[model samples]
Target: MLKTRTGILLLAPAIVLMVALLVLPVGYLIRFSFYLGQTGVQTSGGFTFANYVRLFGDGFYLAILWKTLWVSFVVTVVSAITGYPLAHFMWKAAKRWRAPFTILVLSPLLVSIVISSYGWIVILGNNGVVNQLLQFLGLTTAPVKLMYTNFAIVVGLVHIVTPFMVLSILAALEKIDPLLNEAAATLGANRFRTLWHIILPLALPGIGAGTTIVFCLAISAYVTPAVMGGSGPNFITTLIYHQFVTLFNWPFGATVAAVLLAVALTVVFLYVRVLSRLGAAAPAAR
Candidate 1:
């Protein structure tokens, strides 16, 4: 009883903080979503489902939601594909090389997202480094359209999220027993075979963690998509901003936010379910 009391006391502050900061705001946002709006402005308090109805009923909003999901999926996949090899290398590299490699992988995180987005803009812009290089190489007569495209947004998001993926995979890799690799080798298993059968299975948890984090972050990401994706390839966050700031439709903005929150939660739940199934099946496979 005393230990339980002490634990509760210790947790009280954190619980209070969570309620005050997160729960309260979400509750308020939910309430706000139910309010009615007119001509891009929220009216006096009255409960209505019109905002949600319009969000689901309209084709434009649905298209934006689909685009957001697609962009997030692409970013997560690219981050995982690029991060896995880098993480493996980091885990297997000599002690002297690990620090530098880790730093290189993590350097982007130390910088601000806005700065990073601008850096990508410089590299991916029409007259930027990439186009200049292509011109110098005599590869093209005109600059390639890189900026303000879905490809550019994906590239930026991949760059931002790759560090998270690498760290997650590295954490999992570090937990793996090196003896497992040696044992497989002694059993006449080749490197590729060991990696495919041993390393990958063990690393699925990390990959799943990284993918979930990257997907969540990418789906909610505003600055990178806004700056790189421009006006056409608008994301959910961008639409929320448009409703809240541009149009001053507070009720509708809250509705969009609620929908985004629901979608994010659904994706996370499905991802967890899938990962759990994979985790359960791995032991049987082995």
Candidate 2:
């Protein structure tokens, strides 16, 4: 009873903060989403499902949502693929090399997102460094259009989110017992076979966590996509910004936000379910 009481007391501040900051704002946003907005102005009217109806009924909105999900998926996959190997290298490196390599992986995170996005523009723009190098190498006769595309957006997002994935996977990898690897080696398992049979299964939880975080961040990213994607691809976050800031349609913006929140929650739910199943199955597989 005393321990339980102590635990509740310790959690009291966080619970209150969550209720005040997160729950209240989400509740208000839900209410706002139900309000009516016309001609870029919110009308003083009762709740209606028109906003949601229009969101799902309209093809443009659906396209934006789909594009957002697709881009986010691409970014997440790329981050996972690239980050996992880097993380593994860091984990396996000598103690002297590990710190520097870990810092290099996390260095980008210290830079501001806006600065990072603009930096990519310099690299990816027509007549930029990439094109210049390619031309010098006689790979292309002319500068390729690289900026203002989904590809650019993916590149920028992957740069921003890869650090998170690396750190998450590294944490999981560090927790794994080195003895397991030695044991597998003794059992006639090669490096690749050991990684496939032992390391990957143990690291699934981290990979899943990193993937979900990167996906969520990528989907909701605004500045990176806006600068890199430009007018080529329209994402849900861009739409929400346009509605709220450009059009001044607060209610409709709120509705779009609600939809985005729902989609993010749905993805998180599915990821957690899948991770739980994988967790349960890992020991069984062994």
Candidate 3:
């Protein structure tokens, strides 16, 4: 009982901070979203569902939401596809080499997201390295229009999220028992067979975790998409920013934020549930 009390005391400040910083703000945002008369910079105190109606009834906003989801999905898929091999290599690497490889994987996180997004611009922008190379190679007579496109957004997001995917998968890979591989070999299983039947099944949890983290980060990403997707149709986060800052429609902006939160929560819940079921079934299948 005394230990329990001490634990609660230690956690009290964090809990209070969470409530004060996160919970209260979200609660206020949700409450403010229901206000009417969301014109220009003025919002009336009267509550209404007009903001939600406007969001759902308009195809433009719906398209933005769909685009956000699509881009996020693509980023997550690309990150997983690319990150898995790197993580596997890291996991299998010699002990002396692992630290260097781990630092390389984590290097992206050390840089500001804004800086990283701009770095992508230098690479993908018209007259940038890609276009310059293409022109030099005579592949194109002119610089290709690469910036301010969905492709650029995906590339930026993949760069931002790949490290997360790698770390998640690496954590999962480390949890796997080395003896499992040896046991599979003892049963006459080849490398491919062992990997397919042993390693992958054990790694599903990591893959799922990485996928979730990447998806969440991609969907909610503001910096990369804003920088890379410039003047393109607004992503949900960008739309929310526009509503709040550009449009000065606080009620409507809050509404968009609420919707984004809902979408993210729904996706995460479903993803975790499906992965949990898959995780439970993996051992039985083996």
- RMSD of candidate 1 to the truth, in angstroms, is 2.2
| Per-residue lDDT of model 3, residues 93-172, tens digit only | 98998889888888788788999888888999897999999999999997898989999999988988888999999899
Better of 1 and 3 by lDDT: 1
Task: Specify the highest-lDDT model's number.
Answer: 1
lDDT of 1 by residue, 1-286 (tens): 4698899999999999999999999999988889886655447657888888999999999999989899899899889999999999999999999889978999878888999999999999999999999999999989999999989999999998988999999999999999999999999999999999999988988998999989998999999988999884388999999988888888898899998898789888998899889879878987
| Pairs that collide, model 2 | none
Please write out the lDDT profile of model 2 over residues 7-67, one tens digit for every residue.
9999999999999999999998888889888655546679799888998999999999988
| Worst ten in a row by lDDT for model 2 | 38-47
Candidate 1 clash pair list: none
**Runs of candidate 2 exceeding 4 Å displacement:** 1-14, 38-41, 281-286
lDDT-based ranking, best first? 1, 2, 3
Per-prediction TM-score to the true structure, in the order listed: 0.92, 0.91, 0.92
User: How many backbone clashes can be found in candidate 3?
Assistant: 0
Alpha-carbon error at 184 in model 1, in Å?
Answer: 1.9
Where is model 3 more than 4 Å wrong at Cα? 37-42, 275-286
lDDT at residue 179 of model 2 (Cα atoms): 100
